[model samples]
Target chain A: MKEQLYGLITGILFGFLLQRAQVVRYDKQLGALRLCDMTIVKFMPSTILVGMLGVYLLLDLGLAKLSIKATVRKNMGSGLNIQQGRFSLQSQP
Target chain B: MKTILDKGWSPYLAGALSGIILILSVWFTGKYFGASTTFVRSAGLIEKMLNAPRISKMDYFVKKVPKIDWQWMFVVGILIGAVLASASSRIFRWKALPDMWEARFGHSRVKRGMVAFIGGVVAIFGARLAGG
Candidate 1:
């Protein structure tokens, strides 16, 4: 219940930010895809930097747990091997 | 209100705000932001509803259970937030084909819809394959 509330708040904030940044517009997205607009490029990196710093800080403070798992699947007949990995970090209650 | 709606926040300011929000999200939830997984889960849900037994057997569907998680709520929030923002800005308008699409591909609703649908399908598939 508490976690869902937190998620709701964060999601609202994220959506508001996206709208304010004008990236919700199809043209903005298309322009970014075509390399004609720098809005998304700028917005993404800044968000990544802030998120990374915050996550690391939380980890340092022992407020979060980082779990990483990797799986390797091999196709016997095709001789193809595929590796898939998922990394998740969750806040400690 | 009209003038305000016509103009948007400065890119730098918006970017900074988004960064701050991202930081806050991680600080509170310890989860990264993404919409792809929500899409995958939504597809799984539809498939489950259609044929539960078959969907349940699929590894992908089994691993990513069709449940309304935080990310799903996040997507809902996004839609509501967008509507709120548009309403506040008074720039909310409905149009099937945006100016850019019309200008680039001409005013063909069918064409626009088809292209968008195909693009969305490809993007979702790619995201799933990449395990994003």
Candidate 2:
């Protein structure tokens, strides 16, 4: 219960920041994809830098343990199967 | 200081705050921020309602174990927060087609919906394959 509540609060802050940054806007996303806008590019790097620093600091201090999910791929052929789409549930490695 | 009533904020400021939120999220919960998995779990939850046996047999479902966990609540919170933020900024409105999309792609609701749906599917599929 406590953990769930914390998740909610954290998501709220995240959503708030996303909105305030205007990266959630359709134009901003489209522009970023088209390589015509630097808003998302700028926002993401700053976030990544800070997040990396903070997370590393915590890890170095032994306050948090890193949990990395391994990449798994299964049942995928060498060639792309358009009919099956790029991703398949059966594909895991 | 930008108030809540402001339409938008500096990306740098918002990004910094988001990073702090990310840090705090990890420090307190020992978890990282991710939104895509919530969607996959949601699909699993819905599928479980319709096909319980199939869900059990699926490899991904077995590993993920779809449930309304903390991340799910976090996603719900994200929606609520977005609504609150937009309302506070007095920019909340109902529109099936946004102005920018319409201006670029024209006002064909069907076209817009179809494209958006396809895009969403592709994005979600990629996100899922990449494990969110």
Candidate 3:
């Protein structure tokens, strides 16, 4: 019961934020692709920086437990075949 | 030199709000919110429904995309918010201004949309296949 309530509240808040930030706008997205306006690009580095710090803090406090863990960045090509393996970690030889 | 950003909230506000969305999507859906992935999944579903033989052959189209169709309501909220912001700021006019696309490849909104769609498909497929 507690988990469900947490989810509902969290989803609503997230949705509200996405809408407010213009992240959901087609033009802003397309603009990012074209590099006409890179607010989104600027937004990412800072977002990641903050996220890294927050995650560090959480981990240090033993509060943030990530489930289904894997760290990788995929430079997928498109919608047809969803590829995510461009960059990955491998067992050291 | 005021810009669109000058009119919007501070970066701290935007970033914090976005972080909240990220945290919540993970908590509630057991999934991270990524709009592009869904777009690819949607295309695959459409192609399947149409029995397009080529779709299944593609490296990216074979796998199923995640779902939350009703989640579209969340998207609607986003649209409403953007509209409200633009209107209130009196920046509601659609600017058909020349963009990098127009400069590089000439103008055609249809073409641009198609490129974006194709790009989206390839991007999602690559990311997933690559284990992203």
Give TM-scores of the second chain, every candidate: 0.91, 0.90, 0.55
C-alpha positional error of residue A15 in candidate 2 after TM-score superposition, expressed in Å: 0.5
lDDT for each candidate structure: 0.76, 0.84, 0.56
After superposition, the stretches of candidate 1 with alpha carbons farther than 4 Å from their true spots are A66-93, B1-5
Task: Please state the error at residue A45 of candidate 1 in Å.
Answer: 1.4
- Write one digit per residue (lDDT tens) for candidate 3, span A1-93: 444444444445554444456554565677888888676776666566665565556657765655432433222324223423322233333
- Models 1 onward score TM values of 0.82, 0.85, 0.53
The residue-by-residue lDDT of candidate 1 on B2-106, one tens digit each, is: 666566766667767777776667667776667888998888889888899998898978888988888788888888787787777777889999998888789
For candidate 3, give the docking quality class from DockQ.
Answer: incorrect
User: Where's the lowest-lDDT run of ten residues in candidate 1 chain A?
Assistant: A81-90
Q: Which predicted model would earn the best DockQ?
A: 2
- Evaluate model 1 with DockQ and give the value: 0.39
Q: What's the residue-level lDDT of A89 in candidate 1?
A: 25
Lowest-lDDT window of 10 residues in candidate 3 chain B? B65-74
**Residue B49, candidate 1: C-alpha displacement in angstroms:** 1.8
* Pairs of residues at least 3 apart in sequence or in different chains that clash in candidate 2: A72-A93, A73-A92, A73-A93, A74-A91, A74-A92, A74-A93
In model 1, the Cα lDDT at residue B51 comes to 93
User: How accurately is candidate 3 docked according to DockQ?
Assistant: 0.18
